[model samples]
Target: MPLLRPRDGSAGDAQIPATSAAEVAEHTCAAEAVFHSGVWSGLDPRERAAALLRLADLMERDADHLAALECADAGKPLRECVENDVPGAIESVRWFAEAVDKLTGQSFPAGPGVLALTEREPYGVVAAILPWNYPLAMAAWKIAPALAVGNSLVLKPADTTPRSVLHVEKLALEAGIPTGVLRVLPGTGAEAGEALARDPRIGALSFTGSTRTGRRILTAAAETNLKRVSLEMGGKSPQIIFADALVYGEDLISQTIESAFLTAGQNCTAGSRILVHTDIAEEFTRRFVAAASALVLGDPEDLDTDIGPVIGGGAATRMLAAVEEARAAGARVLLGGTEVPVVEGGHYVAPTVLDRVPAEARILREELFGPIVTIQTFTDEAEAIALANDTPYGLAASVWSAQIDRAIRVSRAVRAGVVSVNSYSEGDLTSPFGGWGESGFGGVEKSLRAFEQWTREKAIWVSLHG
Candidate 1:
C-alpha cells in the first residue's frame, strides 16, 4: 500500500505521494520565492505582531482538532496533546507576539560629535526542521521566533509525524500570514531537510532533534551557504536524588516515573539518567521500578493511559535494540524490557528501567530516547557530578534534596543548560531553552534574546555637528 500523505495535497501535486523528494523540492522552491518577494519580511512590527496573535488564537480555537491529529500521528496521549503540546504551542506564539514590539536594536555611548546606534534586520528566510516527538510544540519553538522577527519559514516536519505541521500551516494561512510565508515540506531528512539546509535562499536553519543529525545539518549549512544554524538536540539528562531530599520519598518516585515516561520518554529533556547516592540507590531503584511497572500502556486517546507508544515502528525498534544492548552489557532490567501490544496496530514499549548500569555501557553514554532509564549509583557529590556529565549531552538536569544549599550546590555543579531543583521537566516560557556541548549551539529565549538570534546588527553613526 502507498504511504499516507500530508493532508495539504502538496504531495499529490508533486507526483511523490507522501513525503517524497519531489514534494520537498517543490516546497523549497516555493519558500525561496516567498523570501525573494519579501512578503513576510516586509511586514511592519505591528502587522507581524497581529499576524502572530492571530495564529495563536487560531491554534487555541482549533486546539482539540490539532491535538487529535497529533495523537494520531505521534502516538502521544490525547491529554498530553490537549493539555500540554497544543497549549504550549499557542503560548509560544503568544509570547513571541508580545516580544515583537519589544525587540530593539542596541545603542552605544558615542564620544563627541557622533551618535552610534545598531539596527537589527531579519535574516530573510528560515528553514525549521522539527522532530517527530512533540512535533507541534518544537515547530512553534522555531516558528514563533522566526516569524516574529520578520522572516519567511520553510518547515520540514519529520517523516513519521508531519500531519500536525500541515495543520499548523493551514492555521497560519487562515490567521492572515501571507501566502508562501510559512510553507511545509513533509519529507525525509535526506531530501527536503538537506535541501532546506543547503538552499542559499534559506538564510538560517533552526532544528530540534538528535545530536548526530544536528551535526549533519551544521555540516550541510556550512558547506552550502554558511547559513546560521540553531539546534536543540539529544540529551541524557540526570536526575540526582541526594540522601537529604524530603521529596525523595514516594512522591519522588512518582514524579521521576512521570518525567521518565512523559511522551514515552521521547523528550529530549527527559531525565533518563538517575544518579542516586550510593546509600539510597537500592531503595530508589525498588521504588522506581514499582511505580514504573504500575503504569498502564494503552491507547493514547484514553485519558487514563499513563504511557503511550513511541513515535513510529522505527523508533520502537531502536529503543528495543538499545534495551537489549544494555542487557548484554550487564545492565539489570528491573521493570520492562519489551514491547507491549496496543490497539489500532499501535507501537507501544513498556516503561523500562535498568539498574546497576555500568558507566561504560552504550546506553549510559548514548541517548536511549524511549520510556527507558538507567540508574547509576554515586558514592559522593563529586561522583554524582561526574556521572551526570559522563554523557555527550548537556541539555537539562534535576536535583532533589531537603537542604536547599546542597541542592543548589549540586544543581550548580551539574554541567547542563537548565537545572530543576526538587522538580522534574518544568519548562517556563520566560526562560531560555537550549543545551551545551553536543546538545546544541544556541538557545530559544522567550524574551528579546530569541529575536536577537534572527536579526543582523548594523551599526549606524550620525554626525552630531551636522
Candidate 2:
C-alpha cells in the first residue's frame, strides 16, 4: 500500500493508505465476479432501493462528521458543506432510492401474433474518477445511481480529498451493501485512475474533471475494451444580463454576484463571463465591482467566510498567471486581482473583477477556476447571444431579462448543457445535469435520466402462440 497524502498542496492531512495499480485491478476483477454472480443485481429492485435509503439514513446520521471532513480536506466553506453539499448528497441518494423502484420497462405488440418488450439491465461494474471539489456530493451522484441500478462500483477519489469517500464506503457496508460491491481506491491519475480506466473488466468509466484529462480517459478507454465513458468537463459559462432586466429588477446586482462567485468561482457552472447590454454596462460594472469587492475572504471553517483559498498553491499560481496575462493583453482590473496576503502556505487569491475585458483577452475566453470574473458588453440581443455562445466550452449559461420571451430565445441560442433564466441555480436532483461540446460527452447525471448511464436496454421478441 502506498501512502495517499491528503494535502491541498498547502498543508497535509493524514495519509490514506492507497491501493496500487495491481490492487485496483484485483478489486475491479473481484467486483466484476460479484456483479456477474448476481448476488446483488438479482435482488428485487425494491430491495436495492431499500438498501440505498438505509445508506442515506446512515449518511444523514454522520452528516456533521462528513461535512467537517470535507471542509478540512478540500478547504470549501463549512457552511456550504453543511447546508448544500452534505444535504444535497443525502437527498440525491434518497431520490435514487425512490426512483429505482418506479423506473419501468416497456412492452408492446409487434404487428400480429408477436409481442415485443424491453428489459433494462445494469452494466456489470462502473469506475468513477471524481475531482476534489464537491467530494461527497460527487460521490453521491455517481455511487447512488450505480448501486441503485445493481451495478458494482470502483470509486477513485481525487488525491487531495480521499478521506470522505472512504468513510462513505464504510457507511455503505454498514447499511448492508454487500462486500466487493463498492471499492474506494485512493491514488493519483497515473496509478489508480489509469488502472480503472484501462481495465477490460470495467463496464463503464465516468469522470468529472478537466477537459484535458477527459480526452486522456477517452483515448485510454479506446485502446482497451472501449468501455462506456462519460465526462463532465470544463466551462467558461456566461451570464448574459440585459439592460431592461437591470433597469427594472430589484436585487439584480446581488443575484449576479452569487452566480459568478459562489464557491469562490470553483463551480463549473459559475458565470465567470458576464455579458451586459451596453446601455446599462457602466452602472452594472460599477455595482458589480463594488459588490464583488465586499465579499469576505477568510478561513473556510468559519461560517462568515465568503471566499476561501483556492485548492492549492499551484491553482492560485495558475489564477495569478491568468490575471497577468489578461492585464498584459490590455484588460483593466476594476477590483482585486492580486494574491491575497497569506501565511506560509495558504493559497488565497483576491476575488477579482476585470472591467470590459476585450473579447480576445484570455480572461474573457478561458475557464479560470478561481474567484476571477470578467465583464464584456453587447449592444443588442443578437450580440449578447453571440458573445455568450462564443466559447468552445459550453457546460452552462444563464440569460437575465424581465422579458420572458427574449430570455427564452437567448437561453436557447447559448450552446450549453444547462441554461437558466432570470435565476442562477445548478438545477435540483430531479433535473438532468450534463454538458455539451468540449464540455465532453455524457448522458445526464441526475433525475430519471441518469438510469441511462448505468444500464443498457435489451429488446425481446416472442411469438404469441409460443
Candidate 3:
C-alpha cells in the first residue's frame, strides 16, 4: 500500500488499501449479489430518490469535514474544496436524486389494436474509476446518478486520493442505502481498476482520466463482457480572444486567468492554449502575464492562496521541463518558468506564460496539467477558428468577442463539446458535458444523458386478440 501524500509532500496519515485483483473480484461478486438481491434496484424510483436526497443532506451537514479530507488528500486549496468542490458534489447528488424519478421512457403509436412502450431498467452492476484531480466531486458525479437509478456500484478511487471517497461510503450507508449497494475499493489502477474493467459482472463502466487509460479500459470491456463504457478523457482546450472583447479589459483578463489556472491547471477543460487576435495580442498578452504573475501561491490550507501545489513532484518536474522545451523551440517565457519553493518538499510550479510558442512545440500540443498557458496569434476569424480546432482534443473551449454574431459564429465553428462565449463555463447541471474527439467516447457525464450510462431501455409491444 502506498501512503497517500498531499501536494506538499508532507507525511500523510492515510494510506489506501492494497486491494488486489482477486480482492477486486470478490468485491465485484458482492456487488453482483446485491444487484440480484433486489434490495436497491428493486426499490421504487421515488424511494431510491429519497434515499439519495438524504445522502445529499448528510453530505451537506458534514461539508466542512469532507472538504478537509479532500484538501489533505488532493492538495487542493481548502477554500476551493469547501466553497466549490464539496458544494459541487452535494449539488450533483441533489440534482440526480431529483431527476431519477422524473426519468421516463417513451410510448409510441403502433397500430389500430396494438401498443408499444419502452421502460428503463438499471444495469446490474456499475463500476466507476475516478481520477485524482477532483476526487469528491467526480465521485459524486458518477455515484449519484448510478445509485439513484438503482444500480450496485463498485467504486475504485484514485490511488493517490482515496480518503474522502472512503468516508463517502460510510455516509451512503448511514443514509439508508443498503449494504453492498455501494463499495469503495482503494487501490492502484493496475490491480483494482483493471479488475473492474475486466470483470464480467460489471454491466457498465464509467471512467474519467487520461485518454491512454481510457483506451485500455475500452479494450478490457471489448475483450470480456462487452460492457457499456463511458470515458471523459484528456484535453488541450483553447481560449480565443478577439480585439473587440478586450474592452471588458480587467474582467476579461480575470476570467481568462481562472480558466487557465483553476485547480492549478489540472482540469481537463483547462484553457491552456490562448489564441488571441493579432490586433490586440500584444496588449492582451501583457495584461494576461501581469495578472497571472500576481496570483498568490502558497499552502493549500491558506484561505488567501490563489494557487496550490500540483499533485506531486513529478508533475512539477514535467511542468518545468515543458516550459524549457517550449523555450528551446523558440517560445518566450513572458512570466514564470521556474518552481516556487513553498513548503520543504511542496511541488509548486510557478504560474507560467509562454508567448509565441511554435505550433509544433510539445507545450502547445500536449496537456501540461499545470499552471502554464501558451499564447499564439491569429489574424482573422478563419485563422482563429482553424487554430482552435487544430488540436486532437475537443473537450471544452471559450470564445471571446464583443460582437454577438461573431462570438456565436466562432462558438459554433469550434469543435468542442462545450463552448462559452465571452466567458468560461461548463454550464450548469443541465448541460451534458463530454468531448467530441479523443477527449471523450461512448457517453457523457452530467444532465439527463448520464442516466443512459447506468440504464438499459427495453421496448414492449402488445397486440389485441380479436
Top candidate (TM-score): 3
**Taking the tens digit of each residue's C-alpha lDDT, what string does model 1 give over 161-187?**
787788889989999998888887777
Clashing pairs in 2: none
> Which digits, one per residue and each the tens of the lDDT, describe model 2 over residues 41-110?
8899889889889999999999999988888788888888989999999999999988987777899867
Query: What's the count of clashing pairs in each model shown?
Result: 1, 0, 0
Candidate 1 vs candidate 3: the TM-score winner is: 3
Give TM per candidate. Answer: 0.93, 0.97, 0.98
Collision pairs in model 3: none
lDDT of 3 by residue, 294-389 (tens): 999988888998898888888888889989988998899998899978866578888999887888888887888999999999999999999999
Task: List residue ranges in candidate 1 displaced over 4 A.
Answer: 1-39, 247-250
User: Which of the two, 1 or 2, has more lDDT?
Assistant: 2
In Å, residue 166's CA in model 3 sits off its true spot by: 0.7
- Whole-structure CA lDDT of model 1: 0.81
Worst 10 residues of 2 by lDDT: 4-13
- lDDT per prediction? 0.81, 0.87, 0.90
